[model samples]
Target chain A: MSENTRLRPGDTIGILGGGQLGRMLAQSAASLGLKAHVFCPDPNSPAFDVCAAFTVAPYEDLDALDRFAESVSVVTYEFENVPGATAAHLDAKLPVRPGVRALEVSQDRLFEKRFLSGAGVAIADFAEIDSQAGLDAALASFGGQGVLKTRRFGYDGKGQIMIRKPEDAANAFQAIGAVPAVLEALVPFDCEVSVIVGRDLDGSSASYDIARNHHENHILKTSTVPADVSDATTRSASAMAEKIVAGLDYVGVMGVEMFLLRDGDEEKLLVNEIAPRVHNSGHWTQDACLTSQFDQHIRAVAGWPLGATERHSDAVMENLIGADVDGWQSVLKEPQARLHLYGKAETREGRKMGHVNRISTRTA
Target chain B: MSENTRLRPGDTIGILGGGQLGRMLAQSAASLGLKAHVFCPDPNSPAFDVCAAFTVAPYEDLDALDRFAESVSVVTYEFENVPGATAAHLDAKLPVRPGVRALEVSQDRLFEKRFLSGAGVAIADFAEIDSQAGLDAALASFGGQGVLKTRRFGYDGKGQIMIRKPEDAANAFQAIGAVPAVLEALVPFDCEVSVIVGRDLDGSSASYDIARNHHENHILKTSTVPADVSDATTRSASAMAEKIVAGLDYVGVMGVEMFLLRDGDEEKLLVNEIAPRVHNSGHWTQDACLTSQFDQHIRAVAGWPLGATERHSDAVMENLIGADVDGWQSVLKEPQARLHLYGKAETREGRKMGHVNRISTRTA
Candidate 1:
């Protein structure tokens, strides 16, 4: 799709990998007079609850993919781990956004790191490790302080292990089931921050305010906006995001996770990871900004002009993890809190149940 | 529900009436992480495409009502025309928001006028006409310039007739099937405006920016925000809205249609009617305000604190009547325009197909 030929209201948008992100994306699309048709394997996926149409078939099914492509004008995915063949299958029939380049970079950790570094962006020190010998040599060169992570299908602190000593490498490899991996020097940082940025097909890019994120048991717990970062640092972060988007020729929202490193007199930044789709940290935008990340993503993918990224108020977004949702009534009673609950059938420990976004003119 | 017992994310909300309004409400509820179970007689209602669950049965089906009430935490309706017994049926089992009082007042034109007048809100000159003689007397008082509208089941110019001359009263009454009706003196207003106001259980109310409406063939064509009215007139319009809400002890968003009449040097406002649910004129809020009417309705009925009522920018909302939806793709190309499409299966003339909300910093 060209930037001039944007999808309008009543146009069908096909979303891949139906989940909460897809659910929110569909809702945003609906609010703007667009229809979303979710295509995913799970028949009970939460995204289907809000979308106008859905296809219950695995991503690998060519017939299902064809039917999904034919049903909507444009297509985008919620998750990056979709098999390369699956994306290729959908792309052949329709416009698949965030493009193949973003998917390729995000699917493999080593490739993602190389891409970031090649774009002249700051990232953690890393070394590729394909076998036991390669891991041993990388560990010896690094003074035995690094993390070994699988190259694919890893998220939320999974498929990785810390290595403090030489003997720990074997168990770490075994922990990841001896999958193809990379070893990188762990950066000791003060806090984690993520920038959710969107790039339209017309090359117009916009970024939301960076967020100071806190996580518990590898799951996001809270995100405070206005990120406690200096105005100069925030500008630099936004510039870095723009560089990444321009480099990838990216379309739609992408999350760039960074570490705020305090080195003596100055605060430095190091890229940690990149998410090809909307990030959990940017959830605050729904309540705090004029246009939300979900809406931005849909607009970018549909080849439409981007909305203003200006925020309306200071915000604090808190995730409702498992029993955290039990006190939903109390949270709702908080006069300025905007609560969002995913209609998940079963809520298990560490699962993302829902979230509350409290907006206040009162700022810290 | 009490103020402290406001609903949070992951709660279930029951919606009565499975039409476009219900579909939009269900989409908003889902965005807030709440599940919606829709109850309507038509199995093929468009809203069923998005809701978590739905029951297809007559409004008076006690068994279905019981099951619906048992499944949802709160019950709200999309239209005011819900049978009085049906609202009572759900109200007896669960909390029905906007309450039966608001529904009763809006369901009948005569009751709406009485309620507005009793609340000290300005209303058009009107009289209840249960017989032909009553209509003749009302017409005589109006000097034969009046409108005869059915007390019940009237919307979008249906069940209404204009009496231009004394001799036309009989045919005008016959046009409405001679049902119980109300005859009102037709005010030569400069413009039509509406205030979409929300009232929480705590008696707190919030009103959206007033919209100046234009109608063609008795069908709403467009609603422009930042209505060209004096500040005093705007204040009175909003105050009248608050009074109406307080009178009904309402707990959801309601649309108050008003006439902008210029009498000598002063502009006066008159309450035309009350829509006890989200109105098409309020569709612009989805893109132009901090909180949308559907979201505000969900928030209010769920006993949550209302969101900010701030309008983002000056906006114009245009309804895509009939085959105008065929040009949806072209409309999407406008950067400032936000399109919203109802998931109706077919497009019929005079039907509310969808709407586009165009927000710009510059006023038209």
Candidate 2:
């Protein structure tokens, strides 16, 4: 778009996916006096309940996409897996923030690794594996151990397998439908962390405090801010995030997951992956900082000035998976716990029902 | 209403009056997984843009009210002047939180003063007046200085006149449309302050920190939390708020405005007015406290437990009236300023277009 693409308060923002993230982004838009129109196929999408308008149609429906684009000044999505064709279609009509290129680069694992490496971002070693034989060959080169992941549509430990032993690789490619994939040597990292960065249309960028993440069952369980890393490590992580966003010409908040490796106090970071939208790890910003990632994302997509990312308190955000949300009553009673429910109808196993942020005065 | 009238996630809340207060309430409800359906006559209501569903019909439209009541599990209002008949109509169908009596008492200044005095709460001395002679008589009894206010439907210093000297009261009665009114003794002591209290269905109550308010052109200009009051004054203000809510059998958030009087080294507080909804003074809680007044109101009306009311930071909430909202860019650039625009289409004079909350780490 143009440098003067800033939206006024009453402008409508079209969101492509209607999930918890979209639900939050819509709410943030409303807080700033802007309107949000969510588009999703699911009638029961949580976001539909909070937006000003919505269209229930598949991404492939060009007519619906056209109408949605007409109603909004800009378009953005909650998830990174938005079809490339869909983003291009909307981009042809209105500005689609983070641009279609960000989606194209982040959609395919091989492309993502190559782009990161080209941009001078530190990442793990990996190779293309189109078949079981190719996977086996790539695994042997990485000392018989690597993560075999599909090139597209993988999330929450799905579409990937850990091939630790020879037997573990047997039919691993077939198990993933033998799709074009990438195999990367799994780094023995000290901890997992992420930085959420917001880049404006004018190339101004701001990054929130790094969050040290923890996973259970390959699903994110908790994210604690003010990551227990050295000041140099924090600075390095932020620089990498800025570099990645600038590399993609990104114009919204992006979550950059990284692996923090420590070799006797000599810390290093490897870019793990990039989400071209708000990520679950950054939810703590909602309560711990003056501006949330959702707010920052909306501001960026609207071409408004980016907000300050300084966090006033230390926070730990824990996801309420499945039945964990049943304890909302007790959580409400906790003085420092800020609960956020996704308004999903059912609590299926492993589904992200909600999350809670527990905060305390900064000690460090 | 039953003893156990708790509303679960995914339940719909019907909100009356589609102004900025309702807009913020709807947004807060969404944050906790509840759907909000707003009802108002104006097609241009700002809250309509944020709610899940909205009815653009007058409050007297019984058929529309029935349809709206059918679509939600419970009902609440953002303003106190929600026609008693309309509130009574919905209360018969389902729970109308803060109940009909709370609305009735607060709707009339005479009734409100009587209720507070009956509840043994400290309040300003006042007398009812119906004619120019009556207003003149009441004014004389109060040292020829008082405020002649309409008993009902008065807000933002509207429907009231200050009778300072004899000539100021010449046409004051006719100026207020000759409505049945109450003349209150003019308070001349100190600062204006307010307390927001949330009472749950179980008769449990919580009070936020007292806020010292500043007004311009009879409209609220700013509210500073942790009002510059002594501990004794603070405790008194909070206790008065709790007493008022309990006396009204209030089951939602209520704003209580008071006048602080300083006598030598002693501090005194007199009840000024009561707002049976989330008060503007409490907006600071959205940024400085774990649970905002809007969040607490939703929880109360939903029959859920109340969250903590402790503020973690010092906050000053300033309303952006009319064209003041045009400075949003500068506000966005302010590191500690949190901006909230009401999405109003026009910048009419005296209109509350939005607000900004600036916070600092608590020092006292």
Candidate 3:
């Protein structure tokens, strides 16, 4: 890819995925006087409603990709699973920030771990399990409970199996369909947290406040600012995110999920995974901060200077999954809640429909 | 209109007018999971881009109006200029919150003054100017310079003219096309300010902090919250807003513009005008307060309880004119400027293209 970067307001931002993340990114871009051109396979994608233009086509359709490139100044994805060939197609034309290297590492669990380890970042104990025997050996090494996950395309608890004991190793491997996977020892952490970091084309970077997150059935439920972790832990988590961005020369909002582990007398953060796009946990920034993560992503990809990630108030963002959004009116009555509903036609079970952020002044 | 207000999340909101207010309102409604269907005469309206459904027919089109009413659960307007017949049509078919009373009282300057006076609200010295002679007579009665304003369809500085001197009255009258207008005595004031108040269907009301405003060429240039007015002035202004809401039985966000005039040893506020729907001056609430005017609007029309109107911090919202949005990158870098762009297809001279809100914690 060429090292040339050019973007500006009024320019169109081409997004690869059309989910809630894409919807918010488009909303943010519109707020900046920039137009978003969403490209996704789902015709019912929520992002289409907020964007100025869109094309619903398979990611591998080179003709559609070309048209999308012609319509936008820069390209970014809302999800990491954007096919490599698709990114390559757009990169060959206009600039694709958070480049292909970042995608390569984030798309696969094994590659992400290797890259983090190489950067001297702390992560969970793990080993690549490409075969059944390899899985067994890895499971034996971890002793007790370990999770065997497919190396690629796994998200929100998909493509993983838990090995509760040595006796269950074979069944666990079989449960994962015997695919190439990575074995990670179960992490005993105090809490799950994430830090959203942004990088510009010029290598500048900034991180938002650490968010303590809770998940139900592997999907994010609520994210609260000023995670119950110590200030030093936040610093370490942000440092890890910055190091990852610098290592990958990444641009745009990248979410680094970490586990706050208590190691005897001290507490440390362990890098669990890296998401190369805006994460759901950062949604509170839309109401609590000066610039939202979506706008930050658009700015970074467009080669604009990174915005300040300082938050103005304490906030909690909760996702309205499936039928939870049905009570939108009651939530709106909360006086302090700022509601966001994605314009999706169908609210099937387990689907993320919208979110609400309740903001309040931080107590000293 | 039946009091059968059971609007849920998946409900459709029919919005009248397709200007930037409608566009932003639609965006906010969608964020809360509600779909917006915009009805306007202009086919290329900016609001069309972000809405799930749109009708490009004149407000007088009964067939279109019937279809629009059948499609959405509730109806509201973005501008105060909703034709009497248009509001009547929607009111007969479905619930139109901030109903015909608001439209009837606000669409014309004469009616607004009469209504406010009847409601026991204080206003400036004014009289109807049906002819050029009427303008001269009002000037003679008021003593010095006054204002000549068209009674209907006037906004910003469009249909209003300042009579700086006795000799300028006829010229100012002629400048405004000598329409059926109002002549008012200009009251000397310290500054102009406004309060944005929201009322639910059940009559519960909430008012945002008074915002001190600045106008250039009769157009709102900027608005700052925790207005530089005294505490007493703020209370009076807010009470005035609440009074209008109760009197009109208004549901949704209404902007009440007032003037702070100094008396002997005290400052008093005089109501200048009433906007039946969301007003430009209240745009700062989106970033500086717990509930934004747009989201609050959606709540009101959806039969939801009004959100809190608490100010989160001291804030300044600045409008971006034709070329003002060009420096969005610099604005984004400010760490405090929160940008909001109206997705207009074209930016013409003196057009309100977008706005940015800069928020900071205020020292008590």
Q: Which one wins on lDDT? A: 2
lDDT of each: 0.85, 0.92, 0.86
lDDT of 3: 0.86
Estimate how well candidate 3 is docked, as a DockQ score.
0.58
What is the per-residue lDDT of model 3 for residues A1-364, given as tens digits with 9 covering 90 to 100?
6465666556788888988888888877876767889999999888877777889999999999998899888888999998989988888898887889999999999999999999889999999987878887777788766988999989889998877877767677678877778999998888899999999888899999999999998999999997877788888988999999999988889999998888775888899999999999999988888778988998888788887788878899999899887877577667578778887778788888888898886522
**lDDT of the structure predicted as candidate 1:** 0.85
Q: For candidate 3, what's the RMSD?
A: 2.2
lDDT of 1 by residue, B1-364 (tens): 3223456567789999998899999988987778899999998686886887889999989899999999999999998889988888877777888888888889899888988999999888998987888888888888888989999999889898888876777667666887899999999999999999999878899898889999999988999988989889888988999999989988999999999999887999999999989998898887766578998999898887777677756789999988988777666566566566776767898877788887774322
Name the TM-score of chain A in model 3.
0.97
**Global Cα RMSD, each model:** 4.2, 1.7, 2.2
- Looking at candidate 2 chain A, the ten consecutive residues that score lowest on lDDT are A1-10
Best by DockQ: 2
Q: For candidate 1 chain B, which ten residues in a row score worst on lDDT?
A: B1-10
TM-score attained by model 1: 0.86
Q: Could you give candidate 3's per-residue lDDT for residues B55-112 as a string of tens digits?
A: 9999999999999999999998999888889899889989997788898888889999
Give TM-score, chain B, model 1.
Answer: 0.96
